[model samples]
Target: MADPSNYTYPSPLEGYEGLEPLPDEKETEGPNAKAFINPPSKTLSKAYNQFADPITNDTRGGFDIHIYYLQTNASELKFAAELHERIRREFPELRIYRLFEGPVGPHPIAMFEVNVFTPQQFGAFVAWLVINRGPLSVLVHPNTGDDVRDHSQRATWMGQPIPLQIGFLKEMLKRKEQEGQTNGS
Candidate 1:
C-alpha cells in the first residue's frame, strides 16, 4: 500500500479501500500472558467473570476481536452513538463491545474488543469493515506495540470499550476488597 489515502484505484480492480481484510492477528507462545493484555490503565482495570476460548478458528468456537483506534480528535459523543446505532441497524446480529459511556473516556478513544460467536457473524463483521470504515482507514494497531494475530487480541477498531476488560477490571477490584477485609479480620 503506497499511502493509506491512496484509495482511488487505477483500473477496474486495481485497488479498493475498505475491501481489504483487516486481519485479527495474535501470538501466544511460552505462556506469555501478554496475549491477554489487561486494561492498560490501572484506573481502567477492574474484574468480572467470563471465558475466552484458547483457540480461535473455524471450529464452532467464538472469535474475540480487539479494535485499536482513536476517534477523530474531539469527536462528539452523539456522533459515535449514532454510528453505533447505524451499525446495529445494518448488522443487528453482531454483538458489539462498547468502550464509551458519556462524552469522554467512555467514547473509546483507543480500542474496543468484540466477540463473534458464529462464522456468519464473523462474515457480517468483515462486510461491516467495508461498509463502515473501508475508505481512507488508517492502519489500526494495538497499544501493546505488537500486531496480534489471534483471538488473544480482539482487533476490531470501532473505538468502543471491550466488555471483558471492563468485567475483569471490576472483578479484580472486588477480589482485592474482599482480600483486604479478610486480612483485616
Candidate 2:
C-alpha cells in the first residue's frame, strides 16, 4: 500500500463532495467558474490504479476489483446480513467478503461497494449472487482525508481460506528425493 503521507492533501474527493454534476449535454460554466469536460463522464474511465490496491501492477496491470451494488429502498444492516447469508451458502470459496452501506440522506443513491482479492474470486461471487447485480463495476477512487478505506473494507467470511497445506517434513522429504534422483548419474 502506498503511504497516505506521500499523497498531497485535500484529495480529489474534497472538490467532489459539493460538486453538482453537469448535464449529459455540453457543459456551461457559471460567470466565474469555467466549465471543462469531465473525461470520465465522456469516455469509459477505465484506468487501473495500483497505488491503493493489492497486486503489483503499475496501476494498469495490477490486480484490481470493484463491484457495484444498488438498492431502491434498503436497510443497510439487513441488506448486509442477507448478503452474508448468500455468500456462505452460494460461494464458499470467497473466504472474506465485505459490504459497506454509506451514510444516508443528501446523497440519495445508496452506494454499496465491495472489494475482494482476485478476479477469480469476484467471478465466483457473481455466479453466486442470489439477489442483485447492476451495470456498474466497483471503482476505487483516489483517497483523501484521514484515508482509511472504510467503505470498501472486508465484511464477510464464508470459511477458512484455501492454502497449500504442506508439512515441513513433506517439503524436506520432497527436496531430498529430488537430490537423490539427481545424484543417480
Candidate 3:
C-alpha cells in the first residue's frame, strides 16, 4: 500500500484535463458571469406532449383532476357549486364535468372532474385551486391506461385525502383484460 503522506493528490479540477479554458471575461467575472443558454424555440417547453411514460401512450398531458366535497354538508355543497361556477367562469378552456350530487365511480364522495391537456394548464389550475379551494379535497391523477394504479399509487391529493374504493376499478380492469384475451384467442 502507498504511504498516505507521500502520495500525490489529484487537482480538484482534474476532470477538465483537456477542456478549453474559460474566456477572459468569464475568468475575470468568476461565478458572477451572466451566462445562460436560451431555448431554441420561442416557447420554453412543448405545450401538448409533456408526460413521457413507457407504460402508456398518453403523452399529451392526459390527466384528471377531481375536486371532491361532501354532499350532506349544505355549506360544502354550496361552496362546491360556487367553486364550479368560478372555475367555469375563469377557465372555460378546461373540460369541467357536471357536479355529481352523490358518489360516482371510485370516489367515495361527491365530486366534479376537470381535464387538463397541457403542463401549463395543470400547473395554473392547481395553483389557482391551492388558493381558492376551501374545505375541498382534490384528487389529481394521470391517465396512463391503468385506472387502478392511477387512482391509487399515482394519485396526488390536496386537503385531507378521502379513501377511494378502487376494488371496482380493479374488477373492471380484470374484466377488460379477460375480454381482450377471449377475443384474441
Candidate 4:
C-alpha cells in the first residue's frame, strides 16, 4: 500500500468555475458601510427575533427536542426515565412536556418533548444531549408553521433516525388549506 501522507486530495472546486468572482474590499465601501451603519431592522439576528420580541411569521420560536427510547427495553426505559428527571432538574426553565408511555402524534416511539424558546437554550440543551443521549434517538426539528416540512425536511437526527408518522400532518395541512379557501371565497 502507498504511504497515506504522500497522497494529496484534489480540490472539489478545482474544475468548477460557474460562480462569479468575489468583490474587492474597496468595492464594498459605500452601500455596505451605509447598511452596516443603519441596518434594515432594529433586530437583524434570527436568534433575537425568534426568541426575544418574536415577529409574527411562518416559523415559530425556538425548536422541539424529542428524546425517544425503546419502551420494550427495560434498561433503556430506566435510562430514559433518569434522563428525563435529570433534564427537568437541570433545565427547570424549559417547557418539558409529560413523558408518553406509547407512540403519540407523529412520533413512533415512547418519548418526551422539550420546548426551548431561545437560541441559548437550544445550543446548551443540544450540546448536553449530544454527550448524555446514549442508546437513545433524538429528533430535533424547528416549529415552522408547516409541520410536514418541519418534521420531514428540516429535522435533525441524533443517532438512528426514527420513522415518523407524518401522513396525518400532511392531511391536516390539506384540510387547513381547504378551510382557508372556503373562508376566502
Candidate 5:
C-alpha cells in the first residue's frame, strides 16, 4: 500500500510525447521569464452561459455553502444556529442541512452545508449571504465529481478560506481506486 502522507501522484501534464519540460524554477527568473507569458483569453459561448443543469442526472452539480463559526464561542454558536434557521426559512426550496457543532466530513470547523440546485438559486443565496452573513466564514464549493479540485481549486470563499481536511477526501478516493483494482484483478 502507498504511504498516504508522502505519496505524490504523477503530474497532470505528464504523458504528452512531444511536449518539452519547462525550465527549472531557478532558471525562470526576473522580468523576461517564461512564467511571465501572457495567458490566453477566456471566451464563453452564449450557449455555454445558457446551459441548464441536468435535473435527471444523479451527478447534478451544486454548491455546498458551508457557514463556519467557532463552536467554543457560545454567542457565535447561537448566531450560527439562528442564521441557519433564517436561511432555511428564506430558501424553502433549497436543501439546508442541520447545523453541525463540530467538524464533519472534510470540513475542519463547525459548519452547516446548504445545497443550491440551480444557478438562479445559487445567485439568490449568494446575494442574501452578502448582506446577512455576519462574523462567520463561508466556504462555497461545487460538487463536480473531481473532489480535490472542487474542494481546493474551484472553491469560492465569502470570508477566509478555512482549510478543509482534503487529505481525508484524497485517501477515500485512493481506497476506492484500490478496491476497484483488486476487484478487477
Candidate 6:
C-alpha cells in the first residue's frame, strides 16, 4: 500500500523567483516612493461597496442582471415569464425591463434585464436568483461606462457562460469612436 503521509505537493511559485520585491513602507522616503505609496485618489460621486466597485462606475453605478433562456423551448419561455413576474413582484423598487423573446441590443439570447441601484439590492436579488434560478443562464454585469469591459471582463454568470454578441458590441464601439472623430472635426 502507498503511504499517504509521504505524498508531496509542488510549490505554487515554482517558476518565478527572479522578480524584485516591492518597496517596503519604511524604505519609501523619496518623492518617487511617496508617489508609489500614496497614489492619486479617484473622485467618486458616492461611496460604493469594495466588492462591487470594479463593476460599478462613478457616474452610472448600477447592475444589470440578465436572465437568459431558449426561446425555442416552450417550457423555458413560460418559466422565464413566470420568473420575470416573480422578480417584479418581489423587488418592486427595481427597474425590471420587458421580457425579450429575441436577442435585444447587445444580448445574444432571449433575455430580460433587471436594473439594481445599490449594493444591498444587488446582493439580495442575486442571492434570490442563485437559489431560485432553474434551467436558465444569467449574465450579471455592471454599467461602468465602458461597454466592452462591462460585458466581457466584469461579467458574472450564475449558470453556464453564454457567449455575448461581442461583434455587435465592437461595431457599436467603432461607430461611437467615428462619431466622436466627426464631431471633433
lDDT-better candidate, 1 vs 4: 4
Pairs that collide in candidate 6 are none
12: Cα error in model 6, Å: 19
Tens digits of per-residue lDDT, candidate 5, 14-81, equal: 55457555545432677776654543447743333332331212335377788999899998899899
Residue 81 lDDT (model 2): 53
Candidate 2 regions exceeding 4 Å error are 1-72, 75-80, 95-98, 103-113, 127-185
Off by over 4 Å in 5: 1-61, 177-185
When sorted by lDDT, best at the front, the candidate numbers are 3, 6, 4, 5, 1, 2
How well does model 1 score by local distance difference test? 0.43
- TM-scores for all predictions: 0.35, 0.26, 0.68, 0.66, 0.66, 0.67
Our model 5 lands, by Cα RMSD against the true structure, at: 9.3
By summed lDDT, which 10 consecutive residues of candidate 2 come out lowest? 155-164
Q: Write the per-residue lDDT of candidate 1 for residues 107-180, one digit (tens) a residue.
A: 22454444555556666675666466422221222222121322124234443333334334446557877999
Backbone clash count for every predicted candidate, in the order shown: 34, 6, 0, 0, 0, 0
lDDT of 2 by residue, 1-185 (tens): 23445445555575368767665554566663455555465543233212233333232322222333345445544554565565567655444345445423111233343433444554455444423532333333222222222112322222221111224334655677799999993
Rate residue 128 of model 1 by lDDT.
68
TM-score, prediction 1: 0.35
Off by over 4 Å in 4: 1-61, 172-185
> CA lDDT of 64 in candidate 3?
90
**What is the model-wide C-alpha lDDT for candidate 3?**
0.79
Choose 2 or 3, whichever is better by TM-score: 3
Task: Name the candidate, 2 or 4, with the larger lDDT value.
Answer: 4
lDDT scores for all predictions?
A: 0.43, 0.39, 0.79, 0.77, 0.75, 0.78
Residue 65 of model 4 has an lDDT of 88
